[model samples]
Target: MSWRIHHVSLPTRDVRETAEFYTEVLGMAESSPPWKDQDRGEFDIDLAHVAWFQGENAQVHLSRHSRNFARDNNFHLDPIINGHVAIEVDDLDAVRERLRRKGVYFADPGNWALSGLDQIYVLDPALNAVEINSQLK
Candidate 1:
């Protein structure tokens, strides 16, 4: 399956400040999050606590850390805990099956963060979280 880096999420105490740094200092344009107006009933995160910035083909997501959200959702892999790099794959199911065959533990959170996108989180050897996702057909 083909895959590419979709975005890099960074946890921050202040989303606005971090967003400003990315946009003003880094010359990245502010981008609207796809889940901004969607009904995030399944996720406990508040939209106000997040920001998005775009740089060419990839994006940077700034999120205010919410430990309660992860704990409440009982997510095995917390995507926002220390931040994560998202990879968009052509076939999410294929990737999932591969992970299963490799005996890699991953958290399947589906579309908890964005509409029309199925997402799963896994950890690298260094214990850094990585998000694998695909656009829903």
Candidate 2:
């Protein structure tokens, strides 16, 4: 079957914060009304509600916590020690500084540069890793 990946859902403790992270830190555009319709609740999906944000090439759907879940469901959601989402930017340092000023903690000031690219890794409010990189000449 032919298919296109319109969006990718990222689970977070706070949908609003996650949406802001994508928009403010990564430069993604938050959708108006900030509401999205998904077939999740109908099929008893794992998420509560999803918010949509537009990136340069693709769209991102931020999943929020639902009432169906219980407090002991920690195992189902653990952002730390897991792989992160990487995004490319024109100015890595500037983005890094912006995130820092927003009280974000970067794993390092700047990681190694390879193949003419500068990189810095950071985490969102939910502890999801975010790699911000720049294409260097």
Q: Which structure among the candidates has the greatest lDDT?
A: 1
lDDT of 2 at 102: 90
Number of clashes recorded per candidate:
0, 0
Kindly report which residue stretches of model 1 are placed more than 4 angstroms away from their true locations once superposed: 36-48
- What is the TM-score of each predicted model, taking all chains together? 0.86, 0.38
Cα deviation at 43, candidate 1, in Å, is: 5.6
lDDT of 2 by residue, 66-117 (tens): 5544333323333223434657676666786787799866654243422344
The residue pairs found clashing in candidate 2 are none
Candidate whose TM-score is highest? 1
Off by over 4 Å in 2: 1-80, 109-113
What would the TM-score be for candidate 1 when compared with the true structure? Answer: 0.86
Q: Determine the C-alpha RMSD for candidate 1 after optimal superposition of all C-alphas.
A: 2.3
